[model samples]
Target: MSALLVQPLVGGHTGAAPAHTGLAAGHPGFLSPSGVEIVFVLVGLVTLGAALVTVTTRQLVHAALWLVVALGGIAVEYLLLTAEFIAWVQVLIYVGSVVVLILFGLMLTRAPIGRSPDADSGNRWIALVVSLAAAATLVTVVVDAFRATWIDLEERTGPGQGSSEVTGTALFRHWVLPFEALSVLLLAALVGAIVLSKRNSDAGSGSGSRPGSTDSVPARRNKAGES
Candidate 1:
């Protein structure tokens, strides 16, 4: 009994020191990332490239297609983060529904499939400056906020950590109002786009059929009949 007590007092957990050091060494460092980190970085790069092309491309169809790629890449990133539910939701909602809706809207509006000079905006420089500033601010804030936060992906944790059930429950329970509001907002935007397109089409048709226009067959026929 005395020897056991004396050993602990003298050694002062000397036997456990190696275990702690080994565990600390086992934890991966930022500089030496695992396979998952490498894949995540690669996916992020692809997603960023897709997003840039979506915004800068003069072809509306290509832009919408690239937008799908960007949104799909985001879903892949969510999958890599182990958020399966969110990944599927991203794929289904944004990649599937929203992108398809955008394509349909483009088709309905008779938007140009090829390069369109109208797609090139006069305020591009201003938009770029604002985007860069906002990106920088967001990066700074996010980095500062999550500076000390770390997750041990390899370590086993409780089932409640990243499960679909927990996510679904939290989303529906806490975020239902916001989700419904967003759905309504999307509906409104869709309706507005259709209405505006119809108005523009009507104005175009009306202008083309003006009574004084020489190209109008009805006007020419009327004058011929009067004469």
Candidate 2:
């Protein structure tokens, strides 16, 4: 009777040990990434490439198209992170509305669709230095902030928690001020773009006229009379 109980207890302990070991093995670590992480990294690379092309390309239309790709890649990243609502919103607002608005603005302003010599300001080296500094600062801040933090993703094995309702609630409840501020910023951007385009158009129209605009018409009329 004693031997039977001992044998069963040993078997139970042995079985439980493997269960714990399997769980620890399943947990993801920094060096061991899951499929989702791999996809996320790949999409991030593509997004970065698209963003670089958008900024570096000489053709305005091609840059806008690459901007679309970058924005779409960000949406894909949100989807991969299980924020489906945010992903869809990103697609609808940024990819659909904002990109279309940009294209329309480009067309209405008569911006060059092909390569334009005025695209770059000949400050590539300065811009690169500034960009590298900014990137380094951001990376340092983020790493320092998150280095001590650890998220137990194993506890979240159930369905996603980023439904539209939940996200909307969270946005309105906690981030309402920022949300309104962003809307104001976007409005400001639109107004600024319109103002700049109008100024450019006025400047372009004035460029074709004589310097002494008030006297040129009179001078032309006198010449015609003399002729």
Candidate 3:
């Protein structure tokens, strides 16, 4: 506890390991699969499935909805990991706000309500190869970087173990720049959405307000050619 708690940074958590690497090998209970782990696996499968559907669905609205499901599953996974703060933020910021913003963007842009033909790209084979290659490269890098490293979850609850407070502090202190950058990106997205809505509205009004519109009386000269 004392060892991990006083870290300037980087400890046994320096790399990665199996998801259950921190399980105590000296204890029999840790050797057996736990119900929590089973639930975690189920949640992971759901997340993966929802993510696949979100990316593959031809219907834009359905894709957005599946994205909500995927993000919600991620929040649940975070909760299962006991990262309550991150879990709630994921729910509030991503599943709730981001998804809502995306839906609104679709509506404002007058996107297709039904299946979008453009959703399917012509480069299916190329995309499949690129995705597989990327996935393989990531797997190789992660395995090489964190072969046997483990995060001691049991230590985290100890008084001396670094916990949520320490993590939040580090995030705010060391990670301020990235957070600020993300905020800027979100602001840009919001402004872009507003601009898109304005353009669509302007176009609609322009088309509606035609010269000599049928619903309106056109200016005409009397028989003497006087207005």
Candidate 4:
């Protein structure tokens, strides 16, 4: 019994080795020749799918989650193309920070967890047309710009590439202002979200209270008295 089990296991391993070796040897030639183009197509498809879901999904949280996936795919593409710095930044900013903030905003705003017809806008057709036109314009511009350049796909960088260092230097030296501006923008967005939420809560509470209730009356009187 022992010999039978051991023989089968050894034979299975032996049979798998050649297949694995063949796949490994062939994969680089196949991938290296056309990997970048394949990845680009895949990235575009993923991004489009995610964007469609984001717009069409009735649940706000689902949209945000789809956005996370889209952003992550972009990061992966960056990494695949040897842009390590951009990839890490994408993960740090979009996946780590922005998505979390969006989720927080969704939770704080008391958005519906389930699908709702109210979430769908009536002007979806107009939006779709505009989006298609913009996409076509971008594609046209890109094709016009790079139509003559031949893409060499097999020349991928190894682990020793200086992408991170150069990116850091560029960010600090030339793009410092833009980086700072982004921080300011994020801060402003946070403040705006907080203010809007607070205003909504206040309005809700105020509406729930009787108009001439003593608490409101005294507050109004105090304001007038102070003025």
With candidate 1 superimposed using the best TM-score fit, by how many Å does residue 186's alpha carbon deviate from the native? Answer: 8.6
TM-score for each model: 0.64, 0.63, 0.63, 0.62
Write the residue-wise lDDT of candidate 1 on 1-227 in tens digits: 96786655434433433323332244444566779989999999999999999999999999999998999999999878878788888998998788888999898567876889879779999999999999999999998664433354543566544568788788799999999999999899989978977984575568675755435555655665554
Which pairs clash in the backbone of model 4? none
Clashing residue pairs in candidate 1 are none
Q: How close is candidate 3 to the true structure, as a TM-score?
A: 0.63
Instruction: Name the candidate, 2 or 4, with the larger TM-score value.
Output: 2
| lDDT, candidate 4, 159-200, per-residue tens | 424388777777899999999999999899889979977984
lDDT (Cα, 0-100) at 163 in candidate 3: 41
Q: Report the lDDT tens digits of candidate 3 across residue range 105-205.
A: 77756678798888878997899899999999999999867544434345344433334676678789999999899999989988997997698457545
lDDT of model 2 at residue 37? 80
| Per-candidate total of colliding backbone pairs | 0, 0, 0, 0
Q: List the residue pairs that clash in candidate 3.
A: none
lDDT of 2 by residue, 1-227 (tens): 96796666545544544433333233444466678888989999999999999999999999999999999999999888778899999999999998998999788567875789888888998999999999999999998654433233332655566768778888999999999999999899989978977984565557567566546555655775554
> RMSD per prediction, one decimal?
11.3, 12.2, 9.3, 15.8
lDDT (C-alpha, whole model) for all candidates: 0.77, 0.78, 0.73, 0.74
- How far is 111's C-alpha from truth in model 1 (Å)? 0.8
How far out, in Å, is residue 198 in model 2? 11
Q: What lDDT score is found at residue 69 in candidate 2?
A: 100
Query: By lDDT, highest first, what's the ranking?
Result: 2, 1, 4, 3
